[model samples]
Target: MKPGRPRMKNDEKQNLLSAGDNRHRRTEQEEDEELLSESTKTTNVCVRFDDSPSGLGKTLQTISLLGYMKHYRNIPGPHMVLVPKSTLYNWMNEFKRWVPSLRAVCLIGSREQRNALIRDVLLPGEWDVCVTSYEMLIIEKAVFKKFNWRYLVIDEAHRIKNEKSKLSEIVREFKTTNRLLLTGTPLQNNLHELWALLNFLLPDVFNSSEDFDSWFDTNNCLGDTKLVERLHTVLRPFLLRRIKADVEKSLLPKKEIKMYVGLSKMQREW
Candidate 1:
């Protein structure tokens, strides 16, 4: 594996990943470091991993590493991590487990409590990372948009697939130099959804959804295997997708079994 940035201290690197019972597998470590490096190079990144073999824990650790790298480089931060309400605490726990040295504050609880956090902790930049829910983001957009964030990491990023949803609109307003999107399911239903992600990531390159759709349509009609290759080439730099079957040899492939049964005459009558 390529070495991590030289500025990263040995202890910091160790802290960036889990140890003990929660230690990352070899592949996980490689992915985490590679992603950390990629974040520096790309403005937007989409990391897609299968739910079975890939753990959000590893992804969260990678995010912590990114925050640390930014701090080390003297970049402005107080990075924002927006996740679903259900995963708010999980993200906090992941940070504590993987990179306890980095201070993280979860903007949850009552309105007054959240407001107090914003006033006392967030505005002053007392924390290295801020973990909030999409709901909270909309409710507190005024406060969040004011900050010049170094990195904005969105978990379950498919939440913004609509591109016009209130949550998506509000998040897009947050001024950040870099963005990272994490999702187990990246493209759910249509190509437009994929376009939504790309537009969010590289607005300059993918400025118009109509243009993106037209390019695909034109290529698909003249396809002689070139369409698939062209799509892959475009996505290669900004997207990373991995499934259990491809990465984990120990995992057994899923199997299906069929059985035939006859219903009783009484059951049929009923």
Candidate 2:
């Protein structure tokens, strides 16, 4: 959850994407092409946002790629996007706002409701993508495992930094052809965490943590030149970093209007 931000009320849910901005739309398209090319060329794609900022359009780009694949590449997906429970509807709204043609379903609610969704909607095989929470994925693993997913995306991917985590273990069991991880945090310092992410992305390439660790040992090294170089070489193909300043250059800096108020006698005492 975002710090200092209150939870969104049911009636307050709105389209996350900007409306009628041709320039922003063009920029998003260009970035989507880059993301599409990179994702298709490699088995695993990691979109890392260095600084979380509004209007970077990561969700839009991902949606666009799904749409492109469905229409242009002839890959009408049985895709799955696993997100936090709070942002489940946010993702659904994004899919509708960005790529309304693709059928996206949300797997949530009570047990009976979920059963109805599974019976009526999921089993029909009419949906292109399924947006669900981490808890739901675990609860319905049996049902999810039945399908061969085309794309499996995990937002806030750092939650699986530990290879032994329940979420990590469960997700690996699913039959997914393509995997994409979206994170709005840095993953540079911890080599083990980095390896865990890489292992998830390309299990064949980065299977051994011990070998990976020994190869880039930072012990007793002056500048860690070799380690840095190796890290770059390994990450260059799979990781696409979007810095807030770089992607949102056209966006204006937020203006803060400060106000000073005199404290009352009760306020001061408290």
Candidate 3:
């Protein structure tokens, strides 16, 4: 929808998308061009906060996330928003109203387009950003396997809160340089439940659930801030956390809330 993004014909996009019969080529330049066009723009992050379940929490958290991403750090790869089927477009609308410069691709496609796009990202600096549902990622496994991800932002990441689930296994399978898990509820089930999510973000940050549990038990009822901050060693490579009170006290006063739902694009240079 933004200017300069090349438009493609429906039949052409459809034909390219429907490559059930032909596997020899990408079917069109725009398909490949979109990937190169997107990955080059901006790094996106997966974000979460402690108070996210409160009113205005999701929006405020997402707003803070955009600000933190833009001003505090510019991670080197495009972000992929992985959420439930319901939350995918909520993410799209947030990006639309908040960070208009970002370009996004919904991982929704005919079997062919999804596979082709993933192959395209194998080249460095392709697709400024991509968003996909957890189901879609599993569906597009062949494509997802082809490239190394600059960052993987798992929204409602609790979907893989269990380390052994097939979804969690698939997420761990990707070659990701950075990882962020976003969820409102941090201590779901118990502190031990947090381990699987943290482990995916930083392998063995706790080493074992019992290890953190023991440390918490021994330290006068205080958990290991040292082990938590020790996360800096691995997590700094992947995570950033901020609270809404950190910024936007004024902009958030009764902001209008609307949800725009759609599976969505790519754009140009800096």
lDDT of each: 0.69, 0.75, 0.59
Q: Where does model 3 exceed 4 Å of error?
A: 1-76, 109-126, 217-270
**Can you write out model 3's per-residue Cα lDDT over 147-265, one digit (the tens) per residue?**
44555778777788778888888877764555767775555325456667777766635557777656444343345667655544544545445455644465555668799865443
lDDT of 3: 0.59
Give me the displacement of residue 252 in model 3, in angstroms: 16
Per-residue lDDT, model 2, residue 259, is 97
Cand. 2 Cα-lDDT: 0.75
Q: Residue-wise lDDT of candidate 2 within 64-87, one digit each (tens)?
A: 778977876666678899999999
Q: Clash pairs of candidate 2?
A: none
Q: Residue 132 of candidate 3: its Cα lDDT?
A: 83
- Once superposed on the true structure, which residue ranges of model 2 sit more than 4 Å away at CA? 1-56, 220-222, 250-270
Pick the lDDT winner: 2
Residue 119 in model 1: shift from native, Å? Answer: 1.2
